[model samples]
Target chain A: MTHLPYIAAAYALAVLVPAAYGLAAMRRLRLARTRLAALDPRPARRETRRETRR
Target chain B: MTAETSAAPGGFEMAPRAAMFRSVDALSSLATPAPPKAPGRSLHRFANPGRFLRLAGALQPWLTAGGLILTAAGLVWGLVVAPADWQQGDAVRIMYVHVPAAWLASAGYLGLAVCSVLSLVWRHPLADLAAAEIGPVGAAFTGICLATGSLWGKPMWGAWWVWDARLTSVLVLFFLYLGHIALIRAFDDPTRGYRAGAILALVGVVNLPIIKFSVDWWNTLHQPATISLTGAPSMYLGMLWPLALTALGYTLVFAALVTARTRAAVMERRIRALLMAAAAREDGAVQVAA
Candidate 1:
C-alpha cells in the first residue's frame, strides 16, 4: 500500500530510532556523578587521620 | 526475575492489567536483595556517594559510543538495505519504529518498579539514581511509541486515533511515566523524594498489565500477535529484518541513555555537595572576619 513516501518513512524511522536513544544517552551523561575522577583517596584519608592524632 | 517489578505486560499481547494487579496479591511485600557487602561498613562503599561518581564517569563514554554505533547502523540497515514488504508494502516498514517504541513503553515502567524495590529494600544510593534517570527516558519512549503509532495508524487503520482498549491503556502508561517523573522531584530531601517515587512506581506498576492485555481481553481495533505466534506476520520476511534492526538500535540506545543519565546523577550529587561546602566555607570566613 505504500510508495516512495513510505520508503522515506522507514528511513526516517531508522534515523529516529537511534536519535531517540542518543538523546536518552545525553540525558544520562548529565546525570553521571563520578567521585573517583576528582578525589585523591590517600590524601583525603591522611588528612582525616592527622586531625584525629591532634 | 525480580519479583517486585518484572518486565511486566501492560494490557499487551503478552500481559493483562488485571493479571499484573492480581499477581500483586501475593507479591505486594516483595523486595529486592541487599548489597553483598557488610550491613553497616562495607555497604558504605557503595553508598559512599564519591565511589559511585567515579564509576559513573568511567562508564558514560563507553555506553554512548556503543549506543551511537548500533543505533546508526540499525537505522542505516532498516532504511537503505532492508527490502520492502509484499503485502503491506512500504507501510509495513513502520513496524520498525512501532514495535520498539511499544516494547520500551512497557519496559520503562518495569525499570522504575525494580529501582523502587531496590531503593525501598536495600536503600542503595544508585537505586534512586536509576529511578530518577529512568523516568524521563521512559516517558520519552512512550511518547515516541504513541507518536509513531499515530503515523502508522493513519496509513493502516484509516484514522489517527481510536478509543481502543490498547490505546487507552498505553495512554495510561504514558501518564504513569509522567507521574513518576513529577513525583520524584516534588520533595526537597531527595531521599524522601526517592521514597515517594518508589511507592508511586510500585502503584503505577498496576497499569503495566492493563496495557499489555488490552488487545486480547477487550474488543480492540489494534492487530494481534506477531512473534510468540505461528505465521502471524501479515508482512513478508523482506521487511522483517529492517524492523528487527530498528528494534536492536532502539534497545542499544536505551542502554546508552541509561548509562549516561546514571552518570549525570552522580555528577549532580557532587555538584550539590561542592556548592554546599563552598557556601559553608564562605560562612565560616565571614564569621571569623566579624
Candidate 2:
C-alpha cells in the first residue's frame, strides 16, 4: 500500500471514464430509438415484414 | 383538318410525324447500353445498417455484461490476489489499468483506420458511423492511457512527464484522435465531414507503427513492450493472468460502446432523413396551394 493514492487514482479513472461513456452511449441510443419511433414507426414494421419474409 | 391530323409547314402530317419521332426515340434508347453498376455492390450486403443494428442490438448486452464482469474480476484479482512485483512492489498493480488502456489506445486506432478504409474505398454507410463513434471512445481511452502512464511514471521514473519517444508518439495519437473527432463534425454536410475524417484517419495510421516501435527505435525513459504478439510475455504468470483478463475486458467494452454509439448514430441519421422528407412534402404541398 505504499503508492495507495496513485493506485486509487488510476483505477478510479479507468473505471469512471469508460463507465460514464458507456452509460452515455446507452442513453443516446435510447433517445435515438424513441425519436425514431416517434418520427416513423416504419422500422419496427419493416422488421416484422422482414421476419415474415424470412 | 382535324387537329390531330394537321400537316406541318414542312409537308408532314403532325400525327404521323409525332408517332414516327416516338418510335425513333425508342429505338435510340434501345441502342444505348445501360450504365454500369458501381463497384463493391457485394460489400453492401454485409454493410447494411438494418442487419448491423439487429446484430449489434443482440450482441451489445452480452458484451457489456461480460466486459463489466471480467473487468471487475481482473481488477480485484490484480489488486488483492496477485503477488506484487519483486522490484516495483505494490506499485506494479497500476499495470492492470495502465497496460490495458495503452493496448486499447493502439487497438482502437487500428479499428478506426479499418473503418476509414471501409468508408473511403467501399463507401460503406455503416463505416462512417462506426468511425465517428470510434473516434471519441478511442480518444477517451488514449486519455486514460496518458493519465495512468503519468501516474505510473511519477512513481517509477521519478518524474510525472518525460519527452520519451514512446510517450511523445502516444501523445501524437491522442491528438490524432481529437483531430478526427473534430473533423468529422466540422462540416454542415455529414458526408463531407465523414470523408474528411476518414482521410485524416487513414493518414494518421502511419503513427501506429511509430508508436509500436518507438521504444525499440530510440533510447527513452519509457520501458519497452512487456507483451508482444510474436514473443512470450516477460512478466510473471500471476501478474500476466490478471492483465490478460483486463485487456480482454477492455476490448469487449470498447466494442460494446462503439456498437451502441454507432447504432445511435444510424438512428440519428434516419431521423434526419425522415425530417428532411417531411419538410420536402410540406414544401410540395405549399407549392401546390400557391
Candidate 3:
C-alpha cells in the first residue's frame, strides 16, 4: 500500500496534465468560434452582395 | 453552386427546387456518410482542415477521459496493491514508469516517423502538422523517462548517472527528441521548419532499434528485459498487469495530448486565414479610393 503512492504520482502526472490541457483547448475553441460568429456580422449581407455582383 | 435561372416575365427566378439545389446538396453531403467509396481504405479527404476539426472535436473528450481513468487505475494497481519484487524490491516499482515512458518514447517517434514519411511521400500538408505537433509531447515523455531512470539509477547503481551504453543511447535519444522539438518552431517559414524536423525525426528513429537492443549487443549496466523468454512473462502476474496498465495509460495520455495540440494548430490556421481575408478586404477598399 505504501509503494502505492509512487505509482499514484506517476499515473496522476501522466493523466491529469494532458486531460487538463485538452479540456482547456476545447473551452478555448468554443470561445473562439463564438468570437468569430460575432465578427462575421450577418451572413445574409455577404450572400446578397455576392448574388447581386455575380 | 452554378445553376441556370428561369427567365420569368417580370422577374429573373429559378424553380424553387433548382434554386435550392446547391444548398440542399451541401446539406445532404454533410448529413450523410455518402457510402464507403473504397472498401480497402477510404480516400484521405478528411485531412482537410474542416473535416479534421470535426473528427478531432468528437474524439478529444473520449480520449482524454479514457486516458485519465486508465492512468489512475494503473497507478493504483501498480504502486499500491501490486506485490513488490523479491529481487529489486521497491526499486522494481520504477519499472511501472520507466517501461511505459520508454515504450512511448519509441512508439511516439514511430508515429512521428510515419507522419514524416507520409508528408515526404504523399506531400500531405496535415501530415507535417501531425508530425510537428507530437514533438513536445514526445520530448516531455522522453525527459520523464530519463529523469525517472536517473532517480532509479542513483539508488541501485550507486550513482546518480553512468556512462553505460544503454543509458548513454537513451540520453542521446532524449537529445534527438529535444532537438526535433526545438527545430520545428525555430523558423519563420513554417514549411521549411516542418520539412527539416521531419528529416530529423526519420533520422533519429533509427536509434530506437539500437537503444532497444543495446543491452544485448554491448556490455551495459541496464538489466535485460523484465518480462522473460516466452508465454506471458517471467515476472509475477500482478506486477506485470499493473506495468501493462500503466503503459496503456501513458499511451492514452500521449494520444489525447497530440489530438489537443493538433486541434489547436488547426484552429490557429483558420484564425490566420480569417485575419488575412479581413486585411485583404481593407487593402482593396484603400486601393479603390486611391
Candidate 4:
C-alpha cells in the first residue's frame, strides 16, 4: 500500500473511463432503437423475435 | 405525384398518412447502400449492417459480463493476492492497469489499421463505422496507459516524464489516435471524413513496430518487454496470472465497447436517413398543395 494513491487512481481510471464510454454507447443505442421503433416497428419486432427464439 | 411523393412506396392504407410516411421513410433507410463491387465475397458478407447488428447484439451482453468478471478478479488478485515486487514494492501493482492499457493501445490501433484496409480497399460499410468507433476507444486506452505509466515512473524512475524512445513512441501513438479521431469528424461529408481518416490510419501503422521494439532499439530508461510470443514471460506466475486475466478482460471489453458503439452508429445513420426521407416527402406534399 506504499503507493496506494497511484494504485487507486490507476484502477479508478481503468475501470471508470471504459464504463462511462460503454454506458454512453448503450444510451445511444437505446435512443436509436426507440426512434427506429417509432419510425417502423418491424425491425424492432424482428429483433425481439430473434431474442425470444434465442 | 411528384418524384419525392412517388418515391414513397404505396401500401399501409389502413394506417394514418403520417404513419404511412414514417413506414416508407424507415423502409428506405433500412435498405443497405451497396458498396462498390469488390472481389472479396467473404469480407462483403459482413458489410450488411442488419447482419452485423444481429451478431453484435448477440455477443455484446456475454462480452460485457465476462469482461467485468475477469477484470474484477484480476484487479483483486493483483492488488491483494499477489506478492509485492521486492524491488518496486507495492508500486508494481500499477502494472495490472498500466500494462493492459498499453497492450490495448497497440492492439486497438492494429484493429484500426484493419478497419482502414477494409474501408479503403473493399469499401466495407461496417468497416468505416468500426474505424470511427475504434479511434476514440483506442485513444482512451492510450491515455490511461500514459497516465498510469507516468504514475509508475514518478515513484520508480524518479521522473514523471521521460524523453525515452519507448515513451516517446507511445506518446506519438497517442497523438496519432487523437489525430485520427479529430480528422474523421473534420469534414462536412462523413464519407470524406472516413476516407481521410482511413488514409491517416494506414499511414500511422509505421509507428507500431517502433513502439514494439523501442526499448530494445535504444538505450532507454524504460524497461523492455516482460512478455513475448517467442519466450516465456519474465515474471512470477502469481503476477503473470493477474496480468493475463486483466489483458483478456481488457480485450473483451474493448471489443464489446467497439461493437456497441458501431451498432449505435448504424442506428444513428438509419435515423438520419429516415428523417431525410420524411423531409423529402413533406416537401413533395407541400409542392403538390401549392
Every model's TM-score? 0.74, 0.85, 0.78, 0.86
Candidate 3 per-residue lDDT over residues B59-124, each given as its tens digit? 656666776776778777766788777856676777777778777777777777777776777666
Q: lDDT tens string, model 2, A1-54?
A: 879989999999999999999889978987888788788887855543543574
Structural similarity of chain A in candidate 1, as TM-score: 0.51
Model 2 / residue B218 / CA error / Å:
0.5
What is the C-alpha lDDT profile of model 1 across B1-290, one tens digit per residue? 12321232121233221222222111121122334453454434456544544444444455556556655665566555667655565666567667877876787678678778878987877778878887887787888788778777887778889989899888988888888899899998989999999999899887887877777788889976565332344444455545544554565566556656665666567666767887999999999999
Q: What DockQ does each prediction reach against the true complex?
A: 0.26, 0.65, 0.19, 0.66
- State residue B22's C-alpha deviation in candidate 1, in Å: 26
Candidate 2 Cα errors over 4 Å, as ranges: A45-54, B1-40
The candidate that wins on lDDT is 4
Q: In model 2 chain A, where is the ten-residue run with the lowest total lDDT?
A: A45-54
Query: What stretches of model 4 exceed 4 Å from their correct place?
Result: A48-54, B1-40
Tens digits of per-residue lDDT for model 4, B96-209:
999988988888887888778878987877788888988999999999999999999998999999999999999999999999999999999999999999999999999999
Superposition TM-score, candidate 1 onto the true structure: 0.74
Q: Candidate order by lDDT, highest to lowest?
A: 4, 2, 3, 1
Per-residue lDDT of A1-54 in model 1, one digit per residue for the tens?
354564466446545654765665664443332232344344335423533564
Clashing pairs in 3: A4-B79, A4-B80
Highest TM-score: which candidate? 4
